[model samples]
Target: MAERRTIVSGSTFEEQIGYARAVVDGDHVHVSGTTGFDYATMTIADDVVDQAEQCLRNITAALTEAGCTAADVVRVRYYFPDRADFEPCWPSFRRYFAGARPAATMLVCGLADPRMKLEIEVDARRPG
Candidate 1:
């Protein structure tokens, strides 16, 4: 049986939403939809590019705690309210996920907070 574990990022929303930042089950790590807010300051950037960059930082923290890296990521999901904001973030995407080349999906939709420009979620495999 796979061992199940939960990772917390200490974001207030995690407590309010009643979910962990990520979960590790056996060899798989499933990260929750993470926003641009810096967990340390809970502050987000106004620019979509900057927000996307911060999203990577936050997701990296959760992935590291789950014993994996972006290289191990198998799937990724991007969420943004504006379609135009999505294209500008491609460079930031390549910065983190270009090498991994994981299966990806981008959604144009509303986020929980209006201040949030984007959110990222990922799934990674733990290497033996």
Candidate 2:
């Protein structure tokens, strides 16, 4: 059987959340929903676009830590507090996802934190 591994991004909520930031099972890497909050500062950015960019940055950091890259991402889930936030940031999202056109979903929902405007989760794969 393939070994299972947990990838922690050093978030303080790991204990409460009861999950790692990512997990590696053989060639597959699954990343958790990442928010705009800077884990180090425990603060969320104000602007929606800035928040989206930061979320992707966090996702990238997690992917890298898991021995994967954005190019390897096969799926992505985006959560927005409002649909209006999506329009201004489409360009930024396009740039980040330029090479890897992963299957994606975007939804509007309430987040745990009121300051958060967007969150993203990614799934990546490496060949066996």
RMSD of each: 0.7, 1.2
| lDDT (tens digit, per residue) of candidate 1 on 6-84 | 9999999999979999999999999999999998898888998988998999999999999999999999999989888
For residues 1-128, write the lDDT of model 2, one tens digit per residue: 97679988777777677989899888899999888878888777789998888888888888888888888999988888888998898998888887899999999999888898888888999654
Clashes of 1: 0
The TM-score of candidate 1 is 0.97
Off by over 4 Å in 2: none
Best by lDDT: 1
Q: Candidate 2's error at 98, in angstroms?
A: 1.7
Going through the candidates in the order shown, the clash numbers are 0, 0
